[model samples]
Target: MVTFFEASLDKISVHHVGNQSQDELYALSEAPLELKDDVIPGLLMQYFLKPFEKSNEVYHLMHSSDDLALNEVHHFATMAFEDESKFHEASEQIAKHLYKVSTHPNIKGGELYVAYFNRVQIEGNPLDAIGIFKSENKETYLKVYPDKGGFVVDYEQEAININKLDKGVLIFNIEKENGYKVVVLDKTTGGQDAAVYWKDEFLQLKVRNDSFNRTNNTMGIYKNFVTQKLDDEFEMSKADKIDLLNRSMKYFKEKETFDLDEFAEEVISNPEAITSFKNFKNQYEEEFGYPIGDSFEISDNAVKKQARVYKSVLKLDKNFHIYIHGDNKLIEKGFDDDKSMNYYKVYFKEEA
Candidate 1:
């Protein structure tokens, strides 16, 4: 579990891989990211910082090497120190956005580096780009963000966007096979059109998939299954289904991670219901072609957002809540002839 924190940058630099248009390669000295009391910078950090601490995996455009993006960043940054003039203008653009993102009310400070490359080789061609990066570290910090009057604080972690960078790549310190988030922004004809790398990866692992997303999707499917069985098939009492849903939510709130088998054993403890769930899971995977993983990092935000789907209530003057989750057809809405009052006619096989 990663905590939220304010993001601060320790060093920043720019590199200009010279073209025939420019006489010599240039670079910017490593400097601090300092924008005191700026709104845009805070917002910029808030947005960019959200993806930090997600995964350490570095993502790249090239298929040949794992550290291709990492190497390019280092190469360009090193060159920037030689001659700073070539990259000064481009560095300003990168800085403008970084400051904008830092001003977001929720953004906490963290150490980050902004590397600008005037021109870097990509697929045997040179392209102008910016590299936003943060080195790997085990330190965690108290994250404080602006509020209505004051602010709030929490723990924080770090990560960066990789699968999609506008004509660029975001590199992380983590290394895994085909495990990176990559983005490619189109800058042809002087227009900035961004495209995510995972869109065309064609490989499952290469796609921009994460445990949080996977868990949300799986929970959505499970909700649908419950809906089908309860609303359409009438396979169980609505009360039971609602109870199960509530219990499942509690599990998600309490546990940091989810295991399919453990969920079956605890949440859906009945043997027959568990069997039904397993069968449905198999059909679900076959139809969707997306495996419901054995374990997942539970998303509390997603769980909170999905809670509305489980709402069931009978209202009376907005003062009383009568939970009627059983068969609605068994209770008929009507008016009592003598009392002239609204009432319900309930049908049952036996009267207690």
Candidate 2:
């Protein structure tokens, strides 16, 4: 969804943000960092842009109130976008907000880099972006220098690794009225409790209703319906459920677009089951407040990701696990009266 091959770091402001609960002080820089060296800017670009290369979900800034101006990150980023002179001032506000939200006991104080980027390609359009990054963890590096012929090893010092980006968000310059398009990465988010500061507290965001999210939501809701809800209203075997799952995935892989009616007829097949699925889907939207569209363009990336979590195995009383991929009818389950035991008969033409 995003590419940074042509991206460059134009300028950046550096600040030190600390954990608020620990009573640590946040230091603000008076001016933006000077990128005088030619190579330093390129290296900085790699550190900031590499992780976003394959980011699929796009987000937009959000606020609890009706007004978008109240959102701290959105306000500052918009100010900086409108006038480059306000960039440093906006960075200060961003850092201050981060410091205020860093209330978790395990949160670490780190250097905050607020940078202006150029030519970040997203969905094929090259747009300017604003990047807010934090470096939390540091590694000890051994320095070695040559005195004469042999190399002399020096002491170790803590330094941030260029390959690791702790927390970051890229806000594209497009869509000002609807809150800018945003993508975030938080590698150091310890747990669900500490994760809110980066995404929810500092930069309030909501998932965009694009193809990727739509596909993801559709797949998720269907999986829940099949695995959890379907058993309540209908009778099904484990093999039958696995076959249904496989068939749905096969349909997603073969088609470019998804239609509710088509999926219901082709995948669920039974009219009674289709009616139950439709009711469950409607209830899901009302319950979660996440609307799943009946028809949308399918995202291949979402399908690939969903495939990893789909269960396709049938566990039979810890004795044998039946792996069903296709044609569940080929496997038959029956009872034996002589030994009073359950048995399964499998059909095959060739053995692998």
Candidate 3:
């Protein structure tokens, strides 16, 4: 299957790529060096076809079919290719940086592919695209140009396809950890904002800092704790759920690091509850194949991101919040003619 597309990707020609940015490029590149050539092909296939978890960083590129941000990409790409010189300059700078990355001793080099697309039509709309793909287990960087040619791309793979490219750049694999990083320069509306995506230890740190990954992981544990640890004899009031979420997020906000013991002491401070939490955490680690560590840095962004997950609500006389874990099935909204007000009916298994 890849063989059919390989020829198309190979057809795109390489352009002039940058200098000085060479040293800066090292910080941005990440692809493992030792993987077999076949490994990369498989990874690429998975990236294009597999549905990424919502929490994954690459979810937008992998799953988003249309959005304003995506449209902006097409606009920028169109402005870029309009002026042949501008297109060449941007393409050249990218190539130069990539070349530097390839030659760097530490960048266990891998194949790099930069494909130019005038525009890809989606849902009766033409959107330009520049695909900066590294044939490795890394993030795919996308650049969308404004409408130029009216080419409809039914699938994402079609846009990233190499064989159908107007121009391309390929660098052989040298290191697996450092492949090709994408830099998008959009000078379309005089606001020259460039977005760059690179994968490395640093990028992972950034992801951690956002607590994006943490929230996702912690949310899962929280749900399990609620389901398994709390006995049916003990009915969890909305207050209990609120306290749990508030304290959990408070720990992330106030603490410099995550200590499981410290978290239990400060947040889930109740002795019996803490014991139950510890048991749940241990069982979760054993069954789920990952340790809930004693320490980790707290991310404010993550706390904010998980505000909805916490869903702590303040109740009023006639109305009370029906906070849920993003599931519509858990609650239903209705209107009352007797009271002439709206109401929510919560669905949960209550213990007598």
lDDT of each: 0.48, 0.91, 0.42
lDDT of 3 by residue, 61-99 (tens): 110333322332233334345553454344444444455
Backbone clashes in each candidate structure, one number apiece? 56, 0, 40
Give the TM-score comparing model 3 with the true structure, all chains together: 0.36
TM per candidate: 0.40, 0.92, 0.36
Pick out the ten consecutive residues of candidate 1 with the lowest summed lDDT: 190-199
Better of 2 and 3 by TM-score: 2
The digit string of per-residue lDDT tens for model 2 on 1-352 reads: 8898888888799999998788898999999999888899988988999889889999999898858999999999999898998999999999999998889988889999999998999899999899999999889888889988899998666687899989999999999888899999988556788877788888988889998999988888889999999899888887888989999999999999999999999999999999998998999889967787899999999999899999998888978988889898899978999999988899999999
Model 3 weakest lDDT span, ten residues long? 1-10
**Model 2 worst lDDT run, 10 consecutive residues:** 188-197
Q: After superposing candidate 2, which stretches have Cα over 4 Å from the reference?
A: 315-321, 334-344
lDDT of 1 at 163: 31
Model 1 per-residue lDDT tens digits across residues 118-172: 3233223333334454222234567799899999998755433333222233432
